[model samples]
Target: MTTQQGTALTHALAEVPGPLPTSGVIHVATPHTSRFTIVGNHLAQHAELSLTAIGLGTHIQSLPTGSRIGIKSLAARFPEGETRIATALRELEAHGYLHRTRVRLANGRITTRTVFRNQPGPTGAPHPEPPTPTSAPAPAPAPAPAAAPAPAPAPTSAPVPAPAPTPGPAPTPPATRGSVPVPAPEPAPVPSASRPAPVPQTHPPAPAPSCPARKGPARLLPQPRELTAELRQTASMLLADLRRHAPELVLSEADIERLTPATATWLERDARPETIRQALTTDLPQPVKYPAKFVRHRLTVLLPPPLPGTEELPPDRPTLVIPMQNCEGCERGYRSRVPGHCRGCRAQLSAA
Candidate 1:
């Protein structure tokens, strides 16, 4: 709106005839012609969403396609920290204003895909707009009330006397410099013996005790074996090369030297160098404060159990022994699994 028009409108409102309200809001709306988003009132006045979530939703809707809305990126752009921003994003996601999914690409790389909806309607339908109010046609003007009969003609010589004004309630007089104000009477005090005893306040009963949470079995470091030169060198190389996989895991020579023995323990248990590296590097925590300490903790806690040797395995149960039996056709002592003829007797029978 133009400045002159706004000023005129304000003056017009001020000149209104009736008494103005003592409280409540008055809106002076202006049309937007550029750089504006069409956010629906459903989102703007959502009952469940917090102010931060609604605002974040609107901001996301206003941004052009391909703009980064990741927590870190948004945290950098706005004053809100990553935790609050993450919470706002979660709220948006829970309320269907935002959707996020982890997608795996053809090249075996994983990435997050986010979608922001301006109006999250069920069944993918657009939210209906509020109907505009239509003004009713003004009623036909009512016939003017008939004028009262002209007052009885008064004598030309006598002037008609004016009617007396109706009286109203008298207004209170303001306090004067010489006036002495009346003081309110004080409440009478009761004797201590006559006063009732004060009742003691009671509190609600305490809640029942909850069971303690179960914890996972503790991880204890395995017994160490003699560290061979080959094992030590391999462990040191693995520890030093960790930075190649995760730059945050960079360690000094002394740190690597101190942690080599722990890593060597994994190697002594027949754990491969690749496995050891993967355990150390995969899923590294954000902002690794002390890389050396983190590596040591992982090396000790995630140590693989030593493989069992052949002699260490329990032996199988002994096989059952078969009983001997005499051959029926041999007429001589012979052994067989069943009562069958010996080879000589069978051959003689065949020849006959």
Candidate 2:
């Protein structure tokens, strides 16, 4: 091949336009760069072959394997919702381009990691999987209940197999064997006083008795007070509402401890659960940094004042004195003491 000419395999496709026709609203299939063209073809081969999968796959494959790919980040970047983004990621996993492995760190913590490749077949990859922690061995089985000792056999004598013949010949009659002569006997004297008395027996003294050690009553520590059923239910309902409004924020136990009192404050102000939910969620920022604080502040500030009771209403009072009709002498309002005159007019007439 000459220096000016390029081989077919290594050569880049050179396209030259020739008197082309015009078209209205053109769609660009591939990006300007060659790497992107490869990526586009990679996505086309695998994936659910849907627009969403293609978009997500293209976005993911553009970055290195160990990149932080959060659901919210993808949702914001693409026009699709969070649910659609999550589904597309799963679809990518179904294809060979994506691999997600759950790794356990040495610190006894576990996390999921994703590995991405534009092409398939990681058959001889050298990365070793995280070690699986060994679980504690089960406790040695309760010593099998000791078998009861076998009962001792009762003592028994063997019976003779055969009867024995009568000893020698039959015994002679008593009369033949009997008969004898009499003899004289002499008397013996009592023992002398000098004979020593039988010696007395002696036994060793008994050893001192032993006393067992005494044990005192065991002392126990006090247990923490448990939350009542009603309070727990209320807290769960409030937290559920909070989670719905702020999905990104996770409340710890300490956060719950701080939020419980705020919930109580809202409850005391005659605020319904739905009202409290709306008040806290009304104009929430896209991402709330401190959910617990924001919720508590809203609950504390949105309280309406208490209404008055029936006892505070006004009582009955006496009517003021006024004339029903105006008098000819003076036109004034007064209680109708005189038929057609004010009190002053009546008094003046009486004086005249």
Candidate 3:
């Protein structure tokens, strides 16, 4: 090839869109025109989040509104299982990417509402600007001093002298009497003209009413009745011993703890330990993928009702009339309502 032609061909190759040359993973970019989710790098590349959490969050964001993302649902859809899915949800919540709140509806049903955020708030994400420091309010400007009244203008002329008292006042002075001296009245205070009037107190608007937190649904298994230390220990032992009956039925500590209460419920219902063992060990699936779930299912489905009390027994019962007695004549056992003789003695006497 000619040098100019080779150069032109190299330029064309460079212009063609292709995966960028890189040592590690390469990316072939494609624009998503119809359906796509835009995730911020802050969340996609979060330093604290694990790979499972990041992926789970991305999947949740892509789903449409009103989608079910519960632990069980997610577990069913993906192979991560319920436990890992639950942990990932918690991680997302801690990082402020998800929020779950239980709210009571007008119909009095309690349900959980979940909210997802693309960008976390101050609680989890870094704040761009430091909080403006709260400064003390500038002291209210001192009330302007009241202006002093202008000195009364000096009289244009000298004040007139008082007239002399009348000379004929001495008719008869009244006799002096003992009396208490009254205190002089104080002068009224002068109001300041520049001082502002007092402002009436205004109460802050009452906070919006909040709904009380209502309890969630009842547990899948019934609780043990009259729970006591002995009952709890017995249930725990029964669960721990199940592995001996069926080697494949081994349960973990968590499983044992969870099933203990249900087992205790069985004992409370008057079920014998042997009977419970038979119920659990008789039906053996070739492989028990989740031992705890299997055990829980059995416990719930096979739970017996409580035994009736003595008062509940029927009042009418069959009575036996014939009572066993020893014959006086021969000392032989006979059946009669009262003391009597054997048939042989009665026949011999009659013959005479």
Best by TM-score: 3
**For residues 4-52, what per-residue lDDT tens digits would candidate 3 score against the true structure?**
9989767765765865566765443557899888776777788889999
State each candidate's clash count.
0, 4, 0
TM-score for candidate 2, please give it: 0.29
- Estimated TM-score per prediction? 0.38, 0.29, 0.40
Give the better candidate number (2 or 3) by lDDT.
3
What does candidate 1's lDDT look like per residue over 1-352, in tens digits?
Answer: 6999989988867776666677885544567999998776878887788899889999998998789998889999999998888888877766656666555799999776566666452323234553111111111111211111111122121132232112111111122111122111111111121131211110111111112245777555444588888888888899989999999998999998888888888988889889988999988889999998888889888888889999999998899776566667756656666777777887988999
Runs off by more than 4 Å, candidate 3: 1-27, 127-352
Q: After superposition, how far is residue 337 of candidate 1 from its true place, in Å?
A: 71
RMSD of 2: 40.6
Task: List residue ranges in candidate 2 displaced over 4 A.
Answer: 1-37, 40-42, 45-47, 121-352
Shift in Å, residue 196, candidate 2: 99
Quantify all predictions' global Cα lDDT against the true fold. 0.65, 0.50, 0.66
Error of 1 at 314 (Å): 32
* RMSD (CA, Å), each prediction: 21.3, 40.6, 25.2
